[model samples]
Target: MPLPDLVRRWQPGWGRCRTLPAATEVPGGLRVVLGLPGRHAEIFALDDQAVPALAERVAEAAEPTWLTVPTTRPGEVHIALENADLEPFPDAERLMTIELDDHPAHPVPNAYWAKTSEFRGVHRIDLTGHDGTVAASGLAAIVGTDAVMHDIRTDPAHRRRGLASAVMSALAVTATQLGATTALLVATTEGEHLYTRLGWEPVATMLTATAPMSALVRT
Candidate 1:
């Protein structure tokens, strides 16, 4: 599928996974009202070509908003800041997808164990330390044939312990059992390397930026 199509597919699942309000379609893309501190809402470009107009629209809005484009386009990023106070965030996110497969059994280390849970269509997996602390955790939500992955994290102290892999394997098994054929997620720079090694392919570069309060003021 095309990059834009994958983004469209990923949005609803992401919203569900995060328990945010449903995203509404806008002239050039989709919009979600986040209502969080320093982040009021977010607009996602439907395609690379829609970014210039979308950025201009974000500049005219009156709230702390984020403008995002799926694929890297330097010219568009420049245009986004040309007439507004938009500050481009680092290019540290990659949208990735993987075909679900039979998750082979993987044993947890002697000092750790795993747990799985589900609630409201979201599946969660956690690798817990021997003392009952979470070492690594991740969430997945199945939307249609796609499962959206979110919040895959391993504690700093748990680094290099393969706990992340264990969590991912558990989530994959859960998603496959839930009838999902593919999985999607926005992976950080560090996560991209891990997911890549696990066979997830990059769909596009995820770019995002937010404007300062002064920039949102309209004359």
Candidate 2:
């Protein structure tokens, strides 16, 4: 399937853009967005209809600091960025997804904090097993006016179980309770079909492109 138009419209700002202290300029029909990566710089070009050609030019001019493409332009080529890598578009099947408007008031299941953990906020459910073994977990974040669902993971051994769906539903309910009108997240191909089946639309295909210092320094 093609990339969702809504996902194509989503653009990152300076704080959210990841690459910073950069500049953007439009030369002709192409817009050149540049970001400084230490001693070198990376560039990206955004042109709705000319995405393919523009991407090529950007790739040639300077390495991309970070980039994303819609599934609509699957034929377009892209490179990865340093300090980050791109996430492939999920298949249009197998992802169970949903959005909620209120925050779940109940205590989140599987609530535990570790020093190096990336998990945050209150998870609605925790799928742990006997002997205190954690099987899976979910996370949510407040990004401006939107409620962002960060990471939702389940153990491979627990596949085919409803644990992931349960966690998602709980988080949606919690988000709604917290006054979030809509929730957003990116799912893997393995999870897309499930999400669509659960009424979560395919908003867009997010392409993660990165540029390393080696690429930039040479450019």
Model 1, span 1-219: residue lDDT tens:
877799998998888878889998888789998887666788987876776677777778787778877885656655555445567775537889888873344567778888888888988898899778999999998999999999998999998988888888888888888899899998888899999888888878777766655333210
Give the Cα error of residue 60 in candidate 1, in Å. Answer: 1.7
Candidate 1 lDDT trough over 10 residues, lowest sum: 210-219
Could you estimate the TM-score for every candidate?
0.90, 0.54
How many steric clashes does model 2 contain?
A: 32
CA lDDT of 121 in candidate 2? Answer: 39
10-92: candidate 2 lDDT, tens digit per residue:
22222132333324444312132444553233333343344444444445544443334444344443332211233222222
Please name the candidate that would achieve the greatest TM-score relative to the true structure: 1
Clashes of each: 0, 32
